[model samples]
Target: MTEIELNGSSAGLSGLTAVPWKNGSLNEALACYFCPQKTLQADRPKLGKVFTARNLSRIAGIEIRWTTNLADHLRLVDDDQVVFIFHCASFLQLQKSLDKSPFPDSFLQETLDTLALLFPSSDNETTNWLKSLTKIDPRLARCGSLRTRERRLENFNYWHDQLVILKQAFDESSPRNISQWWFDRRNGVQWYTFWIAILVFVVTIFFGIVQSIEGALQVYLSYKSIQSG
Candidate 1:
C-alpha cells in the first residue's frame, strides 16, 4: 500500500500529511487530484462506495468537483477508478434531470463530451458496463456496444434508447422526451416559455388595436365625403 503526502499550503513535503488507502494508493491519488486544497492531516473521511439513488446528486457533485480540479496528475491515477467515478457522476446527472423536457442541449452536449474524453478507448470497463446493461434490455443493442464511440451521438434513436434504458434501470419516475415538452423549473425552461408566450400575446393585441384605428379612420373619411356630396 503506497502512501502519499498531500500538502496544499507548502510546495515541499515538510508539512505534508500522509494519506493512506485501504486497497491501494489510487484513492489517495484521487483525493490529491480532486481536493488538493482540502487538508487530510488527521483521520480524514474517505469517499465510500455505498451509493444509492437518493445520494446520486451528491455523487455527481463530487465528480464535478473532480472534473473542475483535474490536472495532468490524472495521467497517474487508475483508469478503472476514473471510469467508475465518471460513469456514476454522468448517470446520476442524467437521472437527476430526467424530468426536464427535451433536456438542455448544452448540458447533454457537455455530458457527451466528457464521456468521450474520459472513455476514449472502447475496450474499457465503461463499454463492459454497457454490455452488461444490455442483458436487462435488448433495445440497448441499438447503442452498438460503443463500437462507434467516436460517433456515439450521431444516431438520435440509439442515443434516446440508451437514455430510456438507463433511466428505467435507475430512475423510473422521470419523464421521457415527448411526455414533458414544456415546463421545467430546474433549467428555467418553463419561465422562458412563459415569457415568450406573453410577448406574443402583447404583440398580437397591439396589431389588433392598430388595425381597428385604421378602419375607424377610413369610415370617418367616407362619411365626410358623403356629406360633401
Candidate 2:
C-alpha cells in the first residue's frame, strides 16, 4: 500500500507505502508498469496511446533528463515508437484509480475558481471551461471526502488525467488562456514604477547636494572678501 501525494492532493493506494518521488519520478512510473496478467485484472484497455514514461513525464511536468538510482531512464528506438515498460504496481494502482475518479477535475475546478478570483484577467477561459465541465458532468463538480487509499488513488488519478487533458486542449485551443496575462501586466507596471521612483529620488538627492555645495562656496567667498577688506 504505497501512498503518494502531490501538491497537496493525495492518492491513496492500498498495500503500498509512500515511495516518494525523488529524481526520476517519470522513470519510476515507467518501471512500475504492470504485466498483462495484472493489467488485465485491472481491466485496462490495451489500445490507443498507452501511457509511457515519456508521456507520464509530460503529464507530470518533469524533464526526461531526470533520473535516480531507484529508477532507470527509458531508451526508445524512435520518438513515435511506443514502448510499454514496467511501472510499480502501486503506480498503476494509483494511476488507474485516478483515471476512474472525479477528484482530479474537482481539484482543477476549485483551483481555477480561486485563481479567477485572485487573478481575474488570466484565468477567464480556464475558469469558464472548468465551470462548463462541472455543468456537463456535475459529478466532476464536487470534491471527494477522505476515503480509503484505493478509492483516493482512483479518484486522484482520474481527476489528474482529466486536468492534463484539459490543460493540453487549453494549450491548443484558440488564444490559449493562461495565468501569464495577469502576471505580464502587473510585472511590467511594478518594474516601471520601481525605476521611476528610483529616478525621482536620485534627482532630488542630486539637487540637494548641488545646493549644499553652492552654499559652502558662497560662504567661503564671503569670508575671503571680509579678510581682504
Candidate 3:
C-alpha cells in the first residue's frame, strides 16, 4: 500500500491502491494527468444553460455513462472514457438537477463528504479528482478559474474551502485519536449552539452568585432591624 505524509503523519492511499490499475502505473498516470500543464479546451460556446448528463457529455466530448455504484464513478479509467456519477444511490438520485446558478454550499459540502469517504487518506488525490471533475465540463472549468468573477468565484472558493475543511476533518478523525471527533463533526449551527450553551451557563452562574450576595445582604439587614427594634 502506498503512503503519503499528511500533517506529519503517514496516511495510506487506500482509494488509489484499491483501483484496478497496478500501483506503479496508477501513480504514473495520476502524475501525468494531474500535472500543472493546462488542459486543452474544446472549441465550444460558454456553457450557460442548465446541464444534463447527456448534454454535458456532448459538450465535453466525453461519454459520461451513468453508474449505479459510486465506486465505479470515482475510479478513472481514462480521460476520454469516464463514468459521471453523483452521490445519490436511489432511483430519485437521477432526478436531481443542476443549473447555471452557483451551487449551494450544502451541495458542495455533500459532494466533498462523498469524495472523502473514498479518498480519506489523501487530500491531494481527493482535490485532484475534484479538479479533474471540474475540468471535464466547460461550464465548471470556466467558472472554477481564478479569473472568473461574481458568484462563480464564490462557488469555487466554497468548494476549495470545503476541501480544506474535509482535510482537517480527516486529520482529526484519525484512528490514532478519536477525542477530536466533535471538532470535525461541528457545523456552523453546532458551533453556534455550543457557544450559546456556554454563554447561558455563565449567565446562570453569574445570576446565582448575585442572588446569594443579595440574600445575604437582606438577611444581615433584617437581623440588624430586629436587634434595633
Per-model TM-score on C-alpha atoms: 0.23, 0.26, 0.26
lDDT of 1: 0.35
For model 1, give the RMSD to the true fold.
17.8
lDDT minimum window of 10 residues, candidate 3 = 141-150
Q: What is each predicted model's overall lDDT from 0 to 1?
A: 0.35, 0.33, 0.37
Q: In model 3, which runs have C-alpha deviations exceeding 4 angstroms?
A: 1-186
The clash tally of candidate 2 reads 20
Q: What is the TM-score (0 to 1) of candidate 3?
A: 0.26
Write candidate 3's Cα lDDT for 89-198 as tens digits.
Answer: 22222223444313233444444433333333233433454455632322221212121121121232223332233223222322122222223232457556766887
Per-prediction RMSD in angstroms?
Answer: 17.8, 18.8, 18.9
| TM-score-better candidate, 1 vs 3 | 3
lDDT of 1 by residue, 179-205 (tens): 232322233675577668878999999
Which of candidates 2 and 3 reaches a greater lDDT?
3
Residue 56 displacement (Å), model 1: 17
Q: Model 2: runs farther than 4 Å from truth?
A: 1-186
lDDT of 1 at 183: 24
lDDT of 1 at 57: 26
Candidate 3 local distance difference test against the native: 0.37
